[model samples]
Target: MGKSSTSVLVILAFFAIYVIWGSTYLLNKVAVQELEPFMLASCRFTTAGILIFILAKIMGIPLSITKKQLWNTIIAGILFLSFGNGVVVWALKYVDSGFAALEISAQPLIILLLMRVLQGKKIQPMSVIGVILGIVGIYLLVSQKQIIAKEESITGMVMIFFCMLSWAYGSLFVAKADLPNNYFVNTGYQMFTAGITLALMSLAFGETWSAPLSWSGGVQLSMVLLIVFGSILAFTSFNYLLKAVSPEKVATSTYVNPIVALLLGWYFLDEQITAQSIIAATILLTGVYFINTKKTLAIFERFKR
Candidate 1:
């Protein structure tokens, strides 16, 4: 693809990822009302993974991966999808999707700090300040008495925190590891490996797939959405963007995702967004700016070699 076409693809992928993944938060909240968390998630992703793997192979994207690469992908899948997504899915039972997305929006800060510690990458001072600001903002937004009820909300927050941590660590590992050269192949490996891991865990827990036919309607709809848009479309678009844009540029999607999720939550579920949420959103975005772009831009000259 030409540069202009590639740029457009990246932009399209970025927006699609932002909207679709953000929309998932509310869907998650609704789904958990009718289905068990891990089991539902396991079913969604396993089906999606299988579909994507088959499609990619049919499209002539190679599925061959070395043993070491397979192991690395397995580890990444566990940390990123199994634990990270699993936590988010579980959190929906205790917390509203809007609330969960707000907490999850703090992921960029976590990722930056993880990069610093694990890779010896030094963040700009402004980025550090941004992280503090984001944390304070998130605190203010979620500190409401009703929202922070002792057992429920607190547990949800804990889940979100670990989810963020696991995701960040896994992303860092993917960045450093040697994997398949083909992005499509790598994506297939990721989804299949991650989905299988979760599926096995679901079986170990003896999760029954015996929902009534009445609720099967919603289950089928969720399954379609998860497979077509969430798993195949979003993952492929993301991988394409990874090739098209710089990593730092692609990371901007993190900032965009929460806003989309907030809007979707409000529109669909009638979720109320108070002044505190507005302030928290601002702080969180500002922190992302510091952690991701502001410092990098300021220090660009030094690293331009």
Candidate 2:
């Protein structure tokens, strides 16, 4: 591919990561209305995993890995998919998709704190302020009268908080862990491992699969979208972006996704976007931008002065 072609494809990949991923939150809400959370997640991942595995094989990518690496990938999958995604799926029963996305937007903040605590990394003062602002944003979001009107909403918000923490830890671990060099192969294993674990959880929890048989066309379509667009396409695009762009650039998805989700939720699901939500989203995304680009932002400020 020529340089211009490559650049266009990179932009498309970024679009997939930002828009498709944001849309998944609302799709999950639609899917879980009829399907059990664990079972729904299991089916989505298993299908996507198998499809990606086949694609990897077709591309002649090696699937071999050490037992230790396999274990590490499995653990990472549990953290990311089972706890991170599965909990959010369950919480969708009580929370709006937009609210869930907003809550998840705080992942960078949590990851920074986790790194500081676990890796003993020192945080700059601006990053510290960013984290504090993120916390305040979350507080403003969940403290709204609409959110606190229901007990289950509070539970859902709390669940999303834990989901962010799990996802952050999984991301940090996977960054340093031994895994397949091929992104498709590595993600295949991770999704497969997570699928199997969620399947077991579905069985243990006595979740019925027959519910999906009675689902509406909209719900069924949402599941297909979640599997194909949300999981497969978006994930592959993300992996591609990690190779093509700087990590900070890829991290902008965290800022863009919540806005996309909020708009979609309001348009399709008629989910309310209150003043508090807008304010919280502004605060949260601004903090995220600062956290991700603190040095650049500081330099820009210097130039302005």
Candidate 3:
């Protein structure tokens, strides 16, 4: 019974990260239509972070951390949430959610290259092939004339590329950083600080803010789901699955999320799934698989959408 129950929980956790995290792309797309991008991220992270902390306290988990840890969490928060997520939300104003998800699916490739450059890690032969395929896939996707013709689309693509860089570097940082020992506490601090940073970024950009009550029903629902499901439930499940399953199994989300986002965007928003995009997604995801086949970048897996 004990083993069966544990297996059930593990399966459910995988569902949460796969479906819920995948759906966040659509949720952010919906919310960004009505809210300032940074502000949308701010509200989601702030509310979720606070709830995590409150839950931690209720469960008698320690919240204390060293000064160095606090500072590291702040940096991680800014990299992973304030810029990585917030900037991607901003890009959704000009880019299709599914398209953005596809491009970001190159994240593991980016992390692998970064490891080569920053850490002097040798690319395993398989990862080297993954890198070549990933590059070709990205070129095929981004070189679409229709997408590049729009100036704003081009700009959104560029910014999202930078956001991927931030996320990749954050993963490398977190792997070695002195963070809170408990994953939940580390995430709480990161989210809370990133929330505050995003709010400031919103204000600095002179973006207008509105009360939740005044938001459109769809946007409001999107925000609620993003906060409670995308930010909280799915994230907690990710942590749980990291303990309960192999890192390679948990890493499957990296490939699955973009596919989910693509399907949802097509079904709900009538977003076109171009033939070229299909080719690109297939190639890109194949590359991600080869990269993760034998190697584990568990920290990199943990941080992305």
List all candidate RMSDs to the true structure.
2.7, 4.3, 3.7
The candidates, ranked best first by lDDT, are 3, 2, 1
Candidate 2 lDDT for residue 148: 93
TM-scores for every predicted model: 0.89, 0.89, 0.89
- Model 1 Cα lDDT, one tens digit per residue, 76-152: 77887788887688888887778788887777678667767866778778777877987898798779777876688
Model 1: lDDT of residue 214: 51
True-structure RMSD for candidate 2: 4.3
Query: Which ranges in model 2 have alpha carbons more than 4 Å from their true place?
Result: 1-12, 211-214, 239-252, 294-305
- lDDT, each prediction: 0.73, 0.82, 0.85
lDDT of 2 at 234: 85
Clashing pairs in 3: none
Q: Global CA lDDT of candidate 1, please?
A: 0.73
Better of 2 and 3 by lDDT: 3
- Per residue, candidate 2 scores C-alpha lDDT tens digits across 94-210 of 999998998888877777777679867666677787889989998998899978999999999889889888887876676566777777777788888999999999999999886
